[model samples]
Target chain A: MTVARAVTCPSCGGSIEIRAAGYTVTLACRHCGSVLDVAHEDVRLITAYKRASANFAIELGSRGTLLDIEWEAIGALERRSPGAIWQEYLLFNPYAGYRWLVLADGEWQFGTLLLDRPEGSLSSVKWRGQTYTLDDSSEIETTIVLGEFYWRVARGDSVQCKTFARGSSYLSSEASGTEVTWTQLVPIDRRDVEGPFVVRQRYKPRPDLRAIREGYSTAPGMDENDLPMMFLVALGALFIIGILQNLLSGPSQCVSNRFDVVVGAADTTHKIGTIDVKRPWQFVTIKADTDKFDNRWVDLDYSLVDRRTQQSIDAYGIVEYYAGTDSDGPWTEGSHHGETLFARVPRGSYDVYVDAGSHGWPSDPRPDTLDPKNPWSAPSTVSVWLAACTGGYSWGMFWTFAVLLFGVPCLILWWRHQD
Target chain B: MSKRLILFSLWSLFLIAISGIATWYAWSPFADDERPTSSAFRGPTHK
Candidate 1:
């Protein structure tokens, strides 16, 4: 039953509907009160409703008055301040993974919204009640962030719904439970959890997590309990350290202005004369960067300009997950398997950068390949698939299945003892 | 003494003209720059 779209009303074209739960009062135009602009030019005025709840709203003015409320609205709570109470949320299961309600304890309905300054962080939501009906250009009050904790909803000693959050607002989820508690950082048996899921049918929440400012969050801190045996011992120690990181690394591909590492979830964002590498040297252009294909990045930066002595360098290309060669030639050291940058670097044609750093590097994107460089590399292990070229590359042919499974049994015992 | 100082100067000019019209009706129109509009809603994103 999701149908409510018809925005119009630039001034009085009059159409209005855009619901995610809003509208009950404060909109007079029996002919003209002119207070409209309900937003819907291209969206983004707060409208995330997968299941919906937190049912409550009261932003009336211009003579506010309307009553159907008989009495006791939750053991008597008729608050009169806190910006006058007019915000309550929850839009469908909120990503419905499961964590709907069980925070027991009666009459919830809390309030406190004040932030002229003082934004360390805060968000608390729970809403339900948007059948329809919202006029006068919508967008009454928008600001949302709700991870979880709401029990269905349907209270009315005369409609009274509002729940928790007053000082710095709260609700977060990075779950882990059993002991760790300081509001947990992770320990619920090493949580990386993603289950109890649900997507279109909506409702995907695993809740039981929090981080109001959490030292800015880099996001990772779990020991290991057995997430598929820690992903098969981290994918067999990254394929035996990617075979000595494929005989010494370099040239998975490099070029930077260091925009955090070329957007950071991994690396690789290239194009260096289409690279054929003949004596211009520094080749291996694109690989490494795989937050499961691509999960949005924030690093790697570069930008050169030898363009006949236009003379430029730009700087800050520190790529390292193991990152080795950025072109000083024949890549070596650590062989390059994950991240490496800012070493000698001087081939040419630059301007490759990434941002969102300081606390947002490749940090933890679940074995996504942040330090590497090819972005994904595998044209027969193209010489240590890059942190920026570590060197020693051999792939003129193709091998490494333990040399065709033990070199055909030692060549039939040396050709049956030399015939 | 002098017709009680002209009836205490007409009751101090009628209480200073009713305290200058209640301080010009509380600083004319609730200044805080007319305040009102505190939007807060965000659900459904990708644009």
Candidate 2:
């Protein structure tokens, strides 16, 4: 059961309603803004409060439903700490005890008092299987009060407050002398509590440490670790598909002909044998082998011309051999043979053309020991080989797409976590 | 469904769509290899 009473402010004679009649020990005058101690029969004035602003989002005495329980806003208090200020509205329900709805920069947090004190150090605390770390500690003073309160609160009354948080949930402890009270709070969306029941007022959210911390802890969407794990699974599946495609492919030699061309002379084009390709999406490989001395290189230009479409695809191949004896040891860099491949060639009769050239110098060229006319030059012979095959796959493209799919979200999450 | 479950489903859908597009691009028959070009042979080149 509950009772209601109307008290007259001794200073201004303004009507102040006390909803929790017997439980209220302090009442503030709505008109005069005077803190009155009404614990006994005679009400005593504790201190006078001057309000800085009257732009409150939720007015006093507004009724709303929270957590499925109907509650009325009975008392309001504004507290300040250094550069920050916040408002706390005391909600009262006959069947349920009092709860605090705090508003800071348009963000609302619902807090309920804990009957028993949680056992832990100030650095860390455990509550209902969740661990909370100490966020901050400060001394907060009450700046303004409205309606009624159950405690003898006065203007300039201060308490040592410490807060701990895990994810979106917070545990706050207010200590006055040796007595401490703990309240567990969680973030509540303002829209959930605003409607016809709530007083309409414009809310603009500002950047604050509390809001930043809470937002970082409660990230929306999938878990941070789950994305990478799923990406690995998808990548494995893609790899398996690539391997299967490679294994099932049939690589047949369409043209296995060899031809020789003179090098170290003017660039000359030679006609290689042609092959009638029967399947599309096949690869044509041009292999070049050169007979060269040490420190010599051969370059060959190749073209595959389709007889039906007259489409000519040009490709190049290189074969080189280099050897040197340094102070460390003997070393060689270039190979004597190389190959180039062209993929997705259409089915047609094709003619192959090769243009060959070569350049070479003695391993240790000395003007005094070598012939002046020849200048230690040598000519080489290049052999051109052509072959065609089917069933080839590109792994680089698959990996590239997979990396982008997994990297973007991970980068975003990492940036947010840093914030 | 809960808000977290809905968010998870949306994220999963986005990831799956991107993966499907990537797989198609990688394995599609319409994909063409880059055309080969003639290049001068440099010294000490390996196959």
Candidate 3:
């Protein structure tokens, strides 16, 4: 390694090493983090910032061997984009010229400044006979600077950077106001850098760590982790919509009637009445209720016959009440009322009929075999009330659709929050 | 707005549109309407 000249900082009077003396244009003070112009005879201060000498992964002036060449770390820059931050360490060898060792996401990339521009546009570039596709593009700002650089680098210097990638190889172009510079980068093993440069364990931070340490705040953007809010908003909107839908559904028009069925007698089908459906499309609800009768169940089959088309929309309901004193004391099973719904029923006058029958518990004997003399015989008659109405909706289907609709976003949020 | 938010908005709009149609027509895949056949039929299903 060639001997380098050391200069005293004009701001803090701290010793600053000019490792790349002749080629270096600006140098940052090691102690005071002041940018100094070193291209001329006088060491002049350019800019001053406090607490700039934060712990870097690879300290300036550290010598490391890479690619069978020994190079000294001469400068480091903290570059930040909207979503990420990375560190670039300028490595210099007199015979080998200059190279870049970039640390991002706790990973290392060996970068070489391209002397000639890569062929093609920002989207797809051909370099060394290989094509690279665009990977990412963002505006990057230099937030911190240390040691010496060939250009007059300063804090808050920003550039539009675009990266093109083909497999593990990447080509990046950083365009400033006057000129654009390209660099070819290849992923390098972290162990190769750590073993040679002896990077401090504590300073090897994932890209965002520096921003956190420096108290950086960013505007809320379209980060995938923010998907939960999107889903919540959608769900909230849907909830309000559901409430409105239920409220708008209606005060339904209904027709109701009652019938008496003789237990242990022959089943009979009776016409309930005609219900006028006034809507173009609506749901029809059929309900059946029975006066209490123990040890016997009544089944009602309802047929809503559309008058014009003579098409019957059929449904079934069971009104049962079974009570007994078993091991669990006095317990009752089954309800005395049951209902069923039909969706999207067309508008028309419909004749509703119900086929009702009653059966005894455990065994249902022939109607002729039941005797009036038998004391344990089922009740003689059971009264059933039937009603049919229009304008009803199913809330279950609506919520099921909502769950399916918001499922993907919920899954992404869950995945992003894991660990 | 970001591309992700735009896409999410589109998705939400699509769901809302279908849900609006479903609600207006009272259409539901879970409707308990039955078809009358010669075979024995099962009774009412709780919502």
Candidate 4:
């Protein structure tokens, strides 16, 4: 059971109610804003202030139910830091002792006295099983005090406070000379406390440590692992499907014809031969071979003209081979011959034309005394073979499209993860 | 339904749709073979 006692403020002679009765040690005159030390029988005036009282969202004497306990606001203290100010409302319950409701930057947090001493350094502390990081450490001074309090709190009383935070909970240690107190605070929603009290205004609370961590982890952005994993899965599936597609396709039937053409000494162009395509859909592969002793490259251009419609399609091929032995090992680059594939050709009678050109490094200087047998170092006789394969499926184009579809997201995820 | 269950279902549906689209594009019937192979005369040692 608790009883309220009425006392007169010595400075202003104004009536003041001490709700905590014997437990109350300080009272501020609501009429003159004077801090009074009520611990002794004769109330002593500690400080006098002329500043106007600031308005609060939760007024003194407001009753509210929090955490399944009934509490009444008995004292209000405004504390100031470097550039910020916050209010701490002392809430009392007959059976629950005292708790604190802190309002800072439109955010509310419920706090209770801590009995167990936490162990760790100033930067980090270990409590129970959780680790907390030091968030702030500073000296805070009380700028104003109103209503009643259990301690002799003056307007200019200062204390050294250190706060450590982990997720949504915070642990604060306050020291005055040799005495120290610890409090554990957890962020609370404003609606939870406003239910039983008449709140004039409500504001959104600032994000706690837990909320900030969740935002960083679960924000609406692509996950670094998810995109790459999806891409790999999609690529694997595509690779398997491509293999199956090729295996299921009809067997390729090829029709090959060879041609030998001799061009005039000065001319590089000549007519090869005529071909009769038998399938509706076929791939045409043209191969060229040239005889050369030293390193040399031969380029050939071929044109397929439709006999009846006079329509034509042009294609080209190249043959080059170079081999040398160095101290390291044997090295070879270009092949002696190369082939090209022209896909999806319609059946028609076609006339083929070939143009060949050769270029290479000049042969090593021949002995001046040796008689020259051949004037040209490159061979003139060119062997060409043309083959058409029907029922062939395309794997290059499909793989390109598949890689692009999956590779883009993978790259984006990689870039984000780097950041 | 619970929010978590609904979210899971939606995610599953999205993945299925993406995979389906990828499969369709990969196995397109109209695609032609344009890839080239090495010369028949060139041995694997040359590569």
Per-prediction DockQ scores? 0.00, 0.12, 0.24, 0.06
User: How many Å off is the CA of A101 in candidate 1?
Assistant: 18
Better of 1 and 3 by DockQ: 3
Where is model 3 more than 4 Å wrong at Cα? A1-228, A247-251, A293-295, A321-333, A365-378, A417-419, B35-47
Candidate 1: residue A132 Cα off by (Å): 41
Docking verdict class for candidate 3: acceptable
Measured over the true interface residues after superposition, the C-alpha RMSD of each candidate is 38.3, 6.3, 4.0, 8.8
TM-score-wise, the better of 3 and 4 is 3
A1-419 in candidate 4: lDDT tens per residue?
66898877754456788888889888887866778888777777777522322345677788999999999998778898876899888999999999999988877899998898889997999988789899999999887676687877756678999999998899999999999999999998888877775555543455799986776576445343355455555566566545644543334555555554332222266666666666554445565555543455555666667899998767666676667767879887676666655655667777766566554433322323233586544434445554544344555545654665566555555555453
- Superposed by TM-score, candidate 3 places the C-alpha of residue A288 at a distance from the truth, in angstroms, of 2.2
What are the root-mean-square deviations of the candidates from the true structure over C-alphas? 35.5, 22.8, 24.6, 23.9
lDDT of 2 by residue, A1-419 (tens): 76998776644445688888899999887876778877766676667522322545677778998889988988777898876899888899989989999988778899999987777887998877778899989999986666677776655678999999898889999999998999999998877777524655555445599977778767654344355454555565555545544443334445555666444456677777685655544556565655555776666677778888889877676667788777878888877677666555666778877677665534323324444587665434555454433334444544654565555556656766654
TM-score of model number 2, chain B: 0.53
TM-score of 3: 0.45
* Candidate with better TM-score, 1 vs 2: 2
lDDT of each: 0.27, 0.66, 0.78, 0.65
- Model 2 chain A worst lDDT run, 10 consecutive residues: A361-370
Q: Candidate 4: give the clashing pairs.
A: A394-B32, A394-B33
Model 4's TM-score against the true structure: 0.35
